[model samples]
Structures are given as C-alpha cells and as structure tokens.
Target: DVRTTFKRMAMNDEETVALTAGGHTVGKCHGNGDASILGPKPEEADVEEQGFGWKNTQGKGHSEDTVSSGLEGAWSSKPDRWNHTYFHLLLNHEWESVKSPAGAWQWEPINMKEEDKPLDAHIPGVRRNPIMTDADMALKMDPEYRKISERFHNDPEYFGEVFARAWFKLTHRDLGPKSRYLGPDVPKEDLIWQDPLPTVDYTLSEVEIEDLKKKLLNSGLSQTELINTAWDSARTFRGSDYRGGANGARIRLAPQKDWVGNEPERLQKVLAKLEEIQQGLDKKVSIADLIVLGGSAAIEKAAENAGVKIKVPFSPGRGDATDEMTDAESFNDLEPIHDGFRNWVKKDYVVKPEELLLDRTQLMGLTAPEMTVLMGGMRVLGTNHGGAKHGVFTDKVGALTNDFFVNLTDMSYDWKPASDSHYNIVERKTGETKWTATRVDLVFGSNSILRSYAEVYAQDDNKEKFVKDFVKAWVKVMDADRFDVKK
Candidate 1:
C-alpha cells in the first residue's frame, strides 16, 4: 500500500515527507496494524540499541507471525497537538528502530524520559502519545526525505505551512479537478465579474454604518463569522450547491440567521440589529450587500480609528433569499470544519479540520489567492483558525489590519510553542504575548505561492494595499455563490 499511498494521493516527494513527519503528532500504534517483532520501550532500552526486526517465533499466535513491528517509542515529546516536534525528534535526536510487542517495526526515542518528552495530545484517544511508524521512518530512510525533515525541524513556520497544504492533500482527496467548474464552461473571468460590480442604492450613511459597526463590534461576534454564515446561506439556496448566489438569492434570507458558526445567537444578534437598521432605511439595497458592505466599512472605520489606511470596496447586488429555501439539512451540510480563528482544528472537533478546509473551500469556488487573503485578514480580525480572543487578537481585538500577516512573516513577534503546534507571539518589551499561529496561519507565511502576498503585505507602506487585497478575497467568498450559472 505504501507504493500507492503517496502516488494515489498525488503527493509530490516534498509533501510526502512533510506529511509523514507531521502526521505522527499524536496517537500510538497499539500493535493492531501488524504484530511481528517485539521490543521494549525506548526508555528501557540502551540509547544506541536497535531492536529485533525479524526474530523467529517458534509458535506465536500465527505460524508466520514475527512478534514485532518496530513501533514502540513515542515519536514526539508533545503528543497532544500538531507541531513540528515530530520533525524535531526525527532530526534533532537519535531514534533506533525497535520492534513492538505486536511485531511492528517502529522507531523509539533513544534518550527521552516520559516526564521530559515533547508531546502532542490533541489526537482522538484519551492520551495518545506520538510514535514513529515504519512509514514515518521512511523520511529518514531516504536521504532526500531526511533533508526536508531537517528543514522543517529547523523552520517551524515553514513546517506548519507545508503540513497544512499536505494534510489537506492527504485527507480530503486525490489528484482531481482543481476547481469544480473549469474554465470555458464556467470561465474564470465569469466567476470573477468586477468590471461592473453592483453599487449600493440605499447605502448606510457613514453614521448608520458606524452605529451598526459599534453594535457588531460590541456584540462579541466576529464579522468574519457573520459573513461566512451569510455566504453559506447564499450558496445553499438552489441545492445543486452552485446556483442562488450570482443574483444574491440568500443574502437577505432569515434562514441563514443561525448556522454552526453563529453559535449562541451571534448571527441572531447581528440579524436582530440588521432588522432594526433595515426598518428605517429604504428598500433599495439588500441585507446581504449591507452585511458585506457594512463589514468592510466597519473595518475601514476600525482601521481609521487605529490610524491605519484602507481602501474598502463596495459590492451591492447581494439580495436576500426570499423564501425559506435552506433547511436543517442544509445547515448541517454547510457547517464549517476548518475554523479560521485558531488556524487549526477546533478542540471540540470530532474530525480532522484540514480534511474539510480544502474540500469546503474548493466547493465554494475560492482560489488560493482568495483563501490566503481571507485567512490572513481573519487572523488580524481575531478570526483565523480556531477560537476567538485566544489573546493573539487580545491587543487589536477588532482592527482589520494586516498586522497578523505582517507580524508572522516579518518575525516581529518571536513565536514559541504554547503546546506542540500552537505558539504565542511574545512581545519583546514586557514579555507579554497574545498572537498565536496555527498550522494554517503558517500556510500564509511559508507557502511559496501564498508567501508572496504575505511578503507584500508585510511592508509598512502597503497598508491600504493589504486592506484592498483582503477585501478582494473577502468579496470573492461573499460573492462566490451569487451567480446563477449552469452547474
């Protein structure tokens, strides 16, 4: 199966190694896969000892069964979360191939103590410790793989970035269509219609926009979360998953007022306010456009209050879904797996979030550029991967600046491990830290394609440019399902 695992998944050599290293973040091999050659844990064995790989068992449970499968030592010290520590252990320390009691060949740590080991415990099991499977050792078995492992070991940010994309490749798909609707049929140009983008007829006056902004900002709900719900509701109207968006079908729908992301009445609160705001305003513009337009406007106001420059866009054709088109099933189908705040899987997630991020993103039809911008902007707005107010956004809780992207790539804040995968950006002066980066955040900083935008936005003078680019990406998501194109 190793022959086809990477090939079938269409992972390039680099991705193969990165994923191999990253995947061992948690969960131990309980000798269920294959039990042949058996050996002791790394703590009990000599530092330089290698265990028996193919020992002759006189009459084990099975005739041809060897007692060991080289899987014993926990691969990482931090076994609860996703982190580059797998690479760190594989590259920085010595690991000897040992056979597990179940006859599996695995690598064990040479000089590690249970109390002192780095671990990642966020895996599914009660206390899943990291262990290097034979597949994982393949990274070192091949010289090229080892080189990449060392690179990732030394560069956590880069490791996280590569791991995120590779993890996406591993869980969700094989080599398939990049976009659901290809060029010519859907035409990239048609998907992106900015030439005559709609303008608001009954636009909120600056004061009204400000009032709505204050209501939203004080409500403890993220604008990104609100926009995402509206986006999903807009996309789910026609049911084939494509229609009902180009003409703004779901923007004004009451059905989208509550979804998975809008928990505890977050979207409800926003909707309630919008209902109040809509009462006084004329019916020229739609709530969908208002949400998007007001969101960007509020961000502009926040930035201005922070003495930041921004050029926000105004797109107005978003109309509300007239009837109750969306149902409970639609909400379930549209629930977001990859949270944008914590930049990693939510702790409460029953499944891997990476698997869902790319799938959901592709289904919604946002490109890499748009995804990158959305993620980056969300991080600054305290809405990147997982949780809100994890202190990374503690400093600038509501400001929609590019400081997250800039600080990450600029290395202004020294990132240190909070667990294995998460880290806090330490403030150099008072030793105070708040901003943290998840594997997903690393993608925006380390991925070659994504990094270009991060680098551009890191510049001091590109403030407005960053904001404009963020809006462009945000608009793509907001407007993705608006058109009534042929599915």
Candidate 2:
C-alpha cells in the first residue's frame, strides 16, 4: 500500500520552506540544470512531419536565425502574425493563381462586333451598362412617387383633375373663365316695366282695403316679436340654420348647487358614489401596516392618538438618551441606517415607504424594539469587519496550517464579537507514520442570520406566536452569543 501522511507546522515569519516526501519521482530529474529543458528548432524538423506549413506558420519566423532559436522566440519576433497583413497577401496570391473551369482565357464582347467574342455563351441579353434609362433612374430615386402613380392610375377623374392642375400651373393659365384677370362682370337689367298700364276705373270698397291694411300690420308685428325673443326661435325652427350661430348663442343650464353651494349636486353625487365604492374596497383589501407619514404633522399626531408606534431618528430633549430624537449626523449614520432602510424598501417594495414598512413588519416581524437591536448590531458588526483580514484554510485535507492561521493572532485583537458569550475548540488527529493535522473553525452572531430566521418564522402559518417566539430567541442570542471581543 502507498501510505501517505500530512502535518502542519507553526513557525515565525522568517521560516519559509515547504517539505513533502514518499511519492515516487515519476519523470527525468533535472535537479537545478536548465540545458535539457530547451525547446525545439524549426528547419531541422520536417515541415510536413511537424505539421508546420505556410498556412499554419503561426510560430514560424521570417529570418532563419529567429526560427532556429526555437518556436517561442521565432513566434515572438514574427511580422506575419500582425492582423490582416498575412491574410490579405495570401488571399491576393491565391486569387491570382486560381483558374476558371473553362480552362482558357476569353475576352468578353465589347458591343456586337464580329472580331470580339460573341455575347457570353452562357447568358444572352445580359448586357453590362454604366447608365440606366431616365424612368428606371427616377423610379430608383423616388420610390414613393411610383407608389402614388400606381395607386391613382385606376381613378381617371382624380388623375384628370391632378393632370389639369399640373398643366395649368406649368402653362400659367386658368380654365375656369376667359375674362382678363378672371373677375366677375355684372349684367344690366332691361327697363321693360317703365310704362304703367291704364287704370281699371272701378274703385274698391273702403272697409275691404281698410281691413287688408290691418291684417298686413298684424303679420309684421308677429314677425318682429319672434325675432326679438332671447331664445332664437326662428333659428331653432329653421333646419338650414341648425348649427349656424347656435354655439355662441347657446345657453346650457348648470346643475343646481349642493347645501354649501360650492360643488354642484350632480358632481357631489358622483364623488359620493366613488367614495362609497372605495370604502367597500377598503373592507376587502388591507391598507399597509406601519404607515410613515413623512412631513405630515397632522397625520403623525393622528397616528399617535391612534396608539401606533412611530420611529424618529433622534431629538435633543425628550427625557431618556434612547427617547431623545436626534438628526442624522453623517453618511455613516444615514447610510447603513436610513439609507439601508430606504434601499430595503426600494428593492423589496419599490420605494413605497408604507409598503416597505409593511413588508418589514410582515416578512421579518420587525417590531420597534427588534428593529432597533438588529440595526444597532449591524452597525457594530460593520464597523468591526470593515477592515479586518479574513482567515485562510488548507486545500486537500481541509486542515489549517499555522502559516494560514497566523492571521488569527491579530484577528482576536481586531474582531469585535457582536455578543458576549462564545467558545472555540482546536483538534489534532494522528495520521500515517509521523504525521498529524489540525483544524479550526469559528461561529458568531450576525443580524443577517437573525433576520433570515425571523423571516422564515414570519412566513409560517402560525406566524403571530412563531414570530414572538423567534424574536425572543433572537434577542437572547444577540445579547449572549459571543466570540473574541476585540479592543
């Protein structure tokens, strides 16, 4: 059996050596000599045998001496390796050497000359030209105009009107009238009614003419009264003037006012119905817990009256040091405390403070006292570990050598345990002939851990009692669990 053993040694900084034995030395030993480790040459080795060619000349050099110095040095000094340089030159040479399958050089016809080759034997009417026809060029340049022409081609009347307008504009002429400057001319009326006919000679009864005058006067009075009315009774009766002058002269009555005479009763009724619907919705859905009424002194006072807990950072004179509310002092005070809460709300509840606080209470069961303790613990822990060096362990056997554990000496002096009570143990075990190993591990209190535990408890079916019990346990651990207390 090929038995093996491991061990860890404790030494000062000056001692620096690693020793291991028992495995067979598998390959040729070089000791400390560098000669046999030299690499291979280029020319002496067969280009085909070594699979090195012009195409695969990634490590080949331009100069013979460079190539003879072996693959690495040759590749380092090679100029062909520069991007696109060798590729373009190689492609150009390959293209020049390539031949057509027809196997003979042939010239294309320049027009239909007899001396020149007949138009390409393979393709007929495949002429090459430098310029296109005017219509083709126009279609290529103005595709939208081609589309419009195709769309209106079937409508002769529309096409005719457009064509006529274009023709008139281009010729600077009008088709409507032939008169100069196209103005209207009035016609003179004939004077045929100038001569009066002879009278009938029979006279009308006096009472009949008098009654006719009275009837005509009464009709004019009725017409004037209809026109003078405020409501435009004539315009309303006349269908031709239905929309004419109706907008400006229109009089729409406003709905009657409510008791306060502020808002109309119709508007108030709509608002009252909406409010009732909202109240009904409120009964089914819950409002957020822990509503933070920032800048709302009135709402804050209302909350106090309602016996809800409120958290204010700090104030100067309230009575107790804890009771006194204080303004945020620096980024340190604001960042991990205020900003941390803000970030928590943003990430979890999208920065809605009420939702954030609600989630904080619901998901973590974070009561005022519980939150204060967790925040204070996080502050203390952050200050301690912000600059401390982390511990290291060995690879294969999962043991920590004294070299790796040396940082622990200063760690005990720098690490401030969040709690007061803790313990540690070191164990060593015997291995194969003349070998031993030692292992070390540490455990400590953390706000993240407690919060995670609280969240799990809060999400349980029996959450109220579970959260209460979890909070008690978390407080006990925070107050008592301890590791080394750094000065």
Candidate 3:
C-alpha cells in the first residue's frame, strides 16, 4: 500500500518528505534493464556515469511489503549514512526531471560531471548514488515541505531531534496511553503563565520595541536596510568569536560600536531602543541578543500590527559583549568589500561575478540557497543603501515579499534602471516603476546558478516558496553568530 498512514495524518509535505528523504539516506533502488528509450539503467551505465535511475514498483515482481515508494539511488553523501545531507543537497542545488529506464518520472542533476558531484563520506562497500523521485521533488516544491526541510538542512542537530521524535510517534502508535511511557503527569496548573512578575526581564520593553519601530519607519530605511544592518553586524567572526567567551555582542563595544561599517546608526537605533527599555525594566537579556532579534522581529511586528502580511520567527539566547574586546582594531576586518549586490557602489563589475560571489560566499559562510535568499531580500527592500533604486521592494515602500526578485526577473514588465542619477529600476509599463537592478541585483539573473533560483521565485506558482525562503534567510542571518542557540 501507499504511505496511507502518512497521508491519513495529513502530515505536511515536509514531514513526509523528511521521512522519505531520510529513509533514502541508506538505500539503493532496483532499476530495470534498459527497457525504455529514456536512458541506460544503473547497471548498464559506466561506473562513474552521473545521472538518475528510477523505476516503477507497481509491476509483476514488486510486493506491497517492499517500501521502495518508486525511488532509488543515493540520498546521502554516502548513500549508506543516515544524515541531514539529503535535505542540504536538495536545497542547495537545482535538479532536472527525467524519464527513468522504467518509464517513470524522476529528477536528476543536469550536466553534472563525475568530479563535480558532491562528495559523500566514504562508506565500506557502497558504490554510487543518483536522484530524487517526483514525490521526493514535492518536498522542495511544496512551500510547507520546503520550509520544514530547511530546519533540517540548516541544523543537522535539530533535524536529528525532530526525526527521532517523529519516528518514535510513527512507530509507536499502537502502544498504550496518555501517561504510561512519557512520564508521570505533573499538575496541569504548572503550564499556566505567571502574570506581572518583577521586571527583571532582559528582553526589549514593549515601549522600546514600539518606539524603535517608529524610528525605523521614520528613518525611511527599507526592511532589508534594517535587517541587513543588523545581520551584517554578526556576519563576521573568523571562527574565533564562537570559541572563547569573547564573542557575544562585542559589536556593542565603544570603538567596535562606532566603527564606520557598523553603519553605527543602525545599531544605534537598536541600542537606543534597548536603553529606552532598560529605564523601565531590569532586563536579564543581553544588549547583543536584542540587537539581533530587533531587526527581523521588530520590523515584522510593526508590519503585522499595521496589517501587512509578513511573519518572521525570533528567539533570544544571546549573551552580551564586554568592553575589553571592543577595540577599534578588533572591528576593522568586518566590513564586507563585496557581496552578491556590489563590490562597492558602482563597483559590482570590478571583479568577475563568480570571484565576487566567491568572496561573499566565503565571507558570509552562506550556502547557495541562503545566499540567493539574502540577495533577493537585500535587493527587494532597497537595503543596499548606496543603490536604493535597484530593488523591487523599493517601489512598494515597505511590504516584505519576493516581488523584488519577481519584478527584477519578470518578463511581462520590462525593468530597467532610470537613466538619471536616481538609481531606480523603472517599469516601461504601468504600476509605478520605482525599482532598479544594480550590478549585484542584475547578477542574480545573469549568473547561471543564481538565475535558476531567481527564476523559481519569479514564477506565480512559487510565491509561497519565495516567502518561506526569505523568512528562512532572515532567521539564518540573525541567528548566525548567536551563541547558545538551540539545535
């Protein structure tokens, strides 16, 4: 039978997907001989041939008890290892659909050479791996599935916990009862929220949060501007910041706090908000964590309160920085010389696009999808500051969405920067052409790898995917260096 249990529970595409994707982490498919005209079967092909192998499991020899689900090939870097690599691989790369030897639909890497394939951990007797099936592809296409999968993709530890919980529930359904295995139940009253406790609270006060919103809006900065300013602060750290206790929010130290690239005003606003909050409550939370959370959380909250349809997730566990680590020299190397948008204003083309991208990729330590989402977000919100006109969100003013990438890449409305010094990407046709694609923004379309993702977000059917991707990226940037983050 099919995954009747999974479908019956109305499990979202992600949970079902994680299971299948994770399940395939260690198995191989049973491919038919070259029966159809599609291509050679796995055994018929050369040892290093790179492509996907698929088959239909509904035929004569197939049995209901075999859990093939019509997919086969390596799902893991080492097809025999059980890990989160499958989710990472799918999220990080573009896959093309193809017909298998058995005339089944499946997805495989397009034009991938042997050396170009991702390296899996070496296993004792394993040979090779191939691709995902159409059902497997749904995990990436379905908004909910893709979003959930990012949890696993971003943090393998978290994935393991979620999978363990899910697997336990799925396999233990028939076992007994409300209290038997979980533990003796505590009093129900233990779950109630305590009210009006002493204000030893460290988090931002409601008034500070509200007032910061006013400043960010009044300052005329876009969402990307605010988020990028905040994200950029923590984006640096040559791996040393996380080792000793020295890392926290040292960005708040005097010289470090005042450094030119800190965009001092951005964090100043965050600090002002925190200071405003400190006057009222004795906060237990550090100024560092608040700054990180303030970017995405505060912005989204203002939008939500005002009735804009944007939602972002936030968590607080960041520790504060000591003044000793905040030397002027300590903050020097943190400013980025280039990113997916520009090397510097008017300097995007100074270096080859790939070289510029490589510099950014290494600097931010972002995966391909993460980088794409960040680029789209920054471009859309006009957050790049130097090139304010080069984003789709610039025209909309303050709604957070993927229309920036869509508008930049859309074929229907021709988007071009204004000829004047305004730096705006204008629409030749109707709806208020206030956007512009800067050198960096243009690369998302020009670069082969970047364009695939840009095109995906541009499609009408993929709007949800775009939203989830942006939110995920926002969270990643905010959480990148926060110590004590949960798995």
Candidate 4:
C-alpha cells in the first residue's frame, strides 16, 4: 500500500523512503486512552459541535489521554529535533510486537536503556520506549527499502537533501508547470514530472495563422484526419495531475506516437504533412500550435458546410518538448485503452462502455452537457477511431451537424443488438440497416439525464446551438493542460 500510493504520486523509492522517515521523525502518536469513548465525527455531531470532530470526554480529552491511529509513542529518541535519530534507533535495536493502551499493535525496542527512550510529551521526569508502526517497520524489513534506510543512516546530509526535494514534489506537483508558480521560494530547476515546455520563441500574427490554416487544409488531409490527430494528441490530458496535453507536442515522442489508440500510421501521415508545412514557413511555429490550428481550421470548415459559419477558437504559443523532457516509462499509465469520445474500445471489459465514457469525461474536467455535445459533433464530423462507421449517423459525414442526436431520437429506426458492445439501427418499415452504433453512441438517448440533453440538440431550432457548444467543448479539451499559456 505504501509503495503503490507513493508511486501514483510520482515518487521513486528513494524519495518515498526520505518522505516517510522525515515525516515520522518529530511527531508522537497519542493512544494512551480508550478509543471507544470518542464522540461522533464533526459532520455527524450535534449543532454545537458541528465544526469539531472526534471529541473525547474522558479526562482532559487531550495530551496524555488523546487517541489517534490507536498507536502510542514517538519514532525518535529526540522527538523535537531534526536529526538522524530515526535511522539510529531503527537500525541499532531489535524490536518486538506490543499493543498500546488503545489495543493497537505496534513495535517497540526490546532491552533498551532508559536514557535512549523518548521523554513523555506532557509529563516531566517520565520516559517511554520508542515505537514503530507496521509501515515504519516495513522500511527495515523490505530488502529494497532496507538498503535505502541504511544509506540514510550512514549519510545524514544526503538524507536531508533528498527528503527536502521529495517534500517539495509531494506538495507542488499538482500546481502544473513551474511557470505558473509565483514567489521567490519556488525552486530554480525543472523536474521531468512537471511536464516542462520551452519558452515560446516567436509569436504568430493573425494573418500568419490564417495562412498556416490554409496550407494545412490544402495539404490533402481530410477534415476527419486533421481533427482526429489533434484530438488524440490532446485527449491524454488529466486535470487531476495537470499532466498530458497538446502543449508539449508529446504525441510525436515515444510511447504516445506508438500507442495503438492513436492510430500511428494515420498519425504519422498527419504529422509528416504538418512538419513539411512548418519547414516551408520563414517564421518559426511549433508543431504543437500547428496541430491545434489544423483541428480548429477543420472544425470551422465543417461548421461552414453545415451553414453555421462560426469560428472555432484558436490559441497559439504552445511549445514543443523534446524526448529528454518526457518520462517515457511514466507515460505508459496515461495511454487510453478505451476512448469513448472517439468511439473506440481497445478490448473487452466488465464495465459498460457508457460508464467508461463517464470516467474519461470526468478526468478531462468536462460536464455532462459538454460531453454530450462533443460526442454528437465528433460522430457527424466522422472522427470515429479506425474509420469505424458505428456512430457516423449523418449522410454528410464531414460536416458538423446535430444529425446524430436527431437520428438517435427519431422513432423510425429500431436498434437491434449486433453484439454485446454494438447495436445496429434498422428501419422499422423495410428492416434495412441505416447505420451501426455502439453502446457509447446509444447511451445519450437511452439515459434519462443524457437523453434530455440529446433532445435539445435534436430539436429544429438548436442546430446552431449544438455547433457552438461542440466548439466550446473542443477548445476546453485542447487547452486542458496549457498551464504555460495564461488564461
């Protein structure tokens, strides 16, 4: 549990060891009293105690009588000082399992001298044996952790340095790129997990942007091809960790370029053309900006074909990151096995496809209505993975339209089961398949809340509203990880 939890937080073994030991060095656990007498949690307590939780009425209810984690005693002999006493006591002594007054199992040093024990927090002239929890003991017992523990014991200076860096990472990692960090205390060096990007060397004028868009459209790539490549590049963003987005242009790097969900062959073709266009221009433009620009241009063209004539918002200044800036191995966890937005599932899973869709949507920080609009728009724009026609409900496949929601809510078609993951929409009168569908496609019209959103797009007057909402959602996904670009 300790190893896995730390790994997800982007900590390595050495950092994990430093953080755990350094954190426990000064704090003493309080479990000297019976835990059964504790009051209800703050939220569940009476009106008077609403903001205060776990009140203990026994004795003074604090100090010597306090109970937390049901374990007692400190890890270091000199508990108030910043020293290597934790490493000293852990390595020098033999320990035995013992229970605190609260009945929780913990480890205590056996046959220890009186002077080596920690002084009681509240009582003068009283000393108690130092204690260790199961997690603390694991550092001494686990072979890999034991080696790191021994190193810290030998060199206190290196141990302190490592612990400080690890502490900084644990606190500031979710704050996005170091560019967003203000104040003088922020560190000078950039870490790989920060997903750092180079400063934008040049800015493009509006005329230059329009010229590049024209070149991208004339590069012989279809509207679906341009949009899908950009979507695939941007879809890896996780608002949770503030990592993986189009700003780094990491889609061209290893792991991501080679991901099966990205459709590598098609990706290479789009990138090749985009790079070629980039080489011909006199002004410098990052492939990161071009990729997003291509998508926006394609979206505008699609909306124009549908008679909406609205512009898809575009923002430039995204910088391309090199392979050295990327942690290739760490990115394996970010790969999409299933992307419900593009209507692709890499393999079968026990969970329903619609549920997987919701999971991905929430991770991208999108609301339910935004998810619905993006889904309907992607289907009509023919951006389904592998050119799978499962959800391409419109005859005008390359145009941005509300035809997906319209056909979905239309009563003339009967949906039949093609397989567990698929459904076929057949005409009720003639019994001929008009279009194929996936559970992800049918879900919007089937679920009550989603169906309500779907019905709004399906109405005659909301076609322009559908196009505008889809463009808004598309921009949100594209810029989800652009922390360097100011809001």
Our model 4 lands, by Cα RMSD against the true structure, at 2.2
Clash count (model 3, backbone only): 12
Q: Model 4, residue 482: displacement in angstroms?
A: 3.0
Candidate 3 regions exceeding 4 Å error are: 1-226, 237-247, 302-311, 326-330, 339-354, 413-434
Model 3 Cα lDDT, one tens digit per residue, 142-235: 7777787777778777777666655654554323121223555422321101100111234555565555445544444445545655655566
- The alpha-carbon lDDT assigned to residue 60 of candidate 3 equals 43
lDDT of 1 by residue, 1-487 (tens): 4424775444667787777667677644434324333344555555555642333333553323323333443566665566556776666556777666556556666775445464323233233324576677778767777788777877888888888777764553422212443356332332111111333345456665455556545545456555444444433322223433434333334433443444435555666666666676544456665566556655565567556676465445454544433332223334444554335443545444444555555666767766666665666665433344442433565666766666767554566778755667787766777566555565566568778877877788877777677766655655554442232
Quote the positional error of residue 255 for candidate 4 in Å: 2.7
Scored against the true structure, residue 58 in model 2 reaches a CA lDDT of: 25
Off by over 4 Å in 4: 51-53, 484-487
Task: Choose 2 or 3, whichever is better by TM-score.
Answer: 3
Taking all chains together, the TM-score of candidate 2 against the true structure is 0.12
Q: Pick by TM-score: which candidate is best? A: 4
Candidate 2 lDDT over residue span 1-487, tens digit each = 0011111111111110001000000111111112223234455546654744322232232321122212110000112222111111211121112111222221111232232111221235432211112222222234543343333333434544544433332232212112112335321321111111112223224453333223322332221121112111001111211111111111111111121111234333333332343355422211100000011112122223323333222111101111011111110111111122211211222343333333433323345445433322222122111111122222211111122222222223233332222222222232212111111112111235443533343242532333234234232222110111111
| RMSD (Å) per prediction | 20.1, 39.4, 18.3, 2.2
Ordered list by TM-score, greatest first: 4, 3, 1, 2
Per-model TM-score versus the true fold = 0.47, 0.12, 0.48, 0.93
Worst 10 residues of 1 by lDDT: 187-196
Over 116-141, each residue of candidate 4 has an lDDT whose tens digit, in order, gives: 89999889989999999888888899
